[model samples]
Target: MKGKKILFILSGSIACFKACEVVSALIKNGAEVQTCATKNALNFIGEATLEGLTHKKVYHEMFESGSYLKHIELNSWAELTLLCPATANIINKIAAGIADDFASTLLAANDYKKPFLIAPAMNVNLYLNPATAESIEKLKKRGVVFIGPETGLLACGVKAIGKMSEPAEILKAVKEVL
Candidate 1:
């Protein structure tokens, strides 16, 4: 991924911390990464941490000054987009054409002709919900690649699916996508 430009989106999920590792790996391997986060995601992982890793501001608001058209610019800048620790809410909103926030709006602006990928993270039951399932199918049909919510112990203290794929696996997927 040397010199590849990536736009990484972080949604609310406990697994959001893992995205830091993903970003670090990308940078360590010579890719340029820019991050956008949901408000709830910032709650889990501080904006400074993201900025510190990427050396760029963490964008979270669609209407923020000097960024009214940032979504379009970000999508246009990226060679690929990665939404790691993608929450059920973000997935559903994207599938439903809701661009209510910077992250979702940026996702909405994506042409999908580029490689866009998501790594789901949520409770097992929520992941399996029919609505969420349908949303996944919808995105898949639109040509979005899903990494995983691999079967394993979850943050909710139960062993099942909905665990975010590890950073190494995510990096592997990103490489494959590129």
Candidate 2:
């Protein structure tokens, strides 16, 4: 994975901590990582931590000056894009072609010419909802890949299948595709 360019996107979730582990592992393996976060994701994981690990500024705003076309540039730059700890909101937005936020904009703008992966983390009910199921199907048909939201104890106090995959598992998936 040396010198591979990965666009790591983070969404709002308690599982951002797990995503951090994946970022660290990616850098350790010599993959170049750039992060773009949803506004809510930063509420859970600090910008400092992401910057410290990625060594690149996290882009979370769609209208930042001189970055009006940044999403397109990022899409062109990345060999792979991983949306870690993906939320139902973001998933639905991307499936519906909504680009209200920076992260959603990035997903919407991507034509899926490169590998795109999402690691979902949310309440089991949301994950299992018909709307989310349809959304996942929509993206999958468009060639987007999904990693595990494994069955386990959730932060919402429910032991169910809404947890994001562990870092090692996600990294393994990344390796497999690359």
Candidate 3:
């Protein structure tokens, strides 16, 4: 994966905290990483941590005056986009093509033919909700791939399939696609 540009989008989930490991793993494999955190995801993991790990700017907004139009540039820059610890809310938003935030905007701008991976993390009920299922189906039909919401203990003190998969597992999925 040398020189592959990986855009890691952290959504609003407690598991977003673990994305540091994913970033580290990707970098260790000689991949270039750029991270973007949703406003809600930042509540759990600070932007500094992501920026520090990526050694590049962490985008977290839709409208900002800067060197270039970030949303469009980032979509073109990334060779692959991975939504680690994708929350139910983010899934719904992306499936619906909502671009309210930087992450969602980048997602909407992505070419469907490009590699896109989503790893959803949410409670069992939310994971099984009709909207969630529908969103997943919609995204799947659009060619977005899923890593896992593995069956295991969750942050909410429940044992179900809504847990984020391990960083190694996520890395493997990324490798397979890229």
Candidate 4:
């Protein structure tokens, strides 16, 4: 999509580093990208790298200067919102309707009419949790799309189904949504 605007919302997960590759691939494929990292996500990837790649300011806080309504602005600017390496914590927050952080706020303010994709990455225990399962179903019913928590070795040193999908796979999913 030449003029499509894709907003990548990264959450705290070891897979956050892979998002850089995702951004690069998206830009190379002719999609405009805007990246915003959750507070915990910043712990893995720096804002400087995100800003440098997208050539757009990376938002992490609601009270950051230069915008009185960053969430609304970002929501309006995005054609599709994609949350890569979506953490179990962030997923729960979104499912519970929490909007305390910039990423969560944007997600909360997003219109369901637009495409919303989430790629979860967590331990197998968390992935298999009943709560997480229910939340996934609820989000699906609400029209949210999921990329993958592909089966593989996890950050916790366990072999299971909680790894983030490969960047190519995620990019393909994005294309399908767009």
> How high is the lDDT of residue 80 in model 1?
97
Tens digit per residue, CA lDDT, model 2, 1-178: 9999999999999999999999999999999999999989999999999999998999999888978999999999999999998999999999999989889898888978899999999999999999999999999999998998899999989899999999999999999999
Using alpha carbons, what is the TM-score of model 4? 0.97
| Candidate 1 per-residue lDDT over residues 1-178, each given as its tens digit | 9999999999999998888999999999999999999999999999999999999988998888999999999999999999998999999999999988889889989899999999999999999999999999999999999999899999999999999999999999999989
Task: Mark the regions of model 2 whose C-alpha exceeds 4 Å error after superposition.
Answer: none
State the displacement of the C-alpha of residue 47, model 2, in Å, after optimal TM-score superposition.
0.6
**Could you estimate the TM-score for every candidate?**
0.98, 0.98, 0.96, 0.97
For model 1 the TM-score comes to 0.98
lDDT of 3 by residue, 46-144 (tens): 888988888998888777678247878888888999999899999999999998778888888888778999988899999999999999999999999
Model 4, stretches more than 4 Å misplaced? Answer: none
Error of 3 at 10 (Å): 0.6
Task: Give per-model CA RMSD.
Answer: 0.6, 0.7, 1.1, 0.9
**In model 2, what lDDT does residue 94 have?**
91
Clashing pairs in 1: none
Give the least accurate 10-residue stretch of model 2, judged by summed lDDT. 104-113
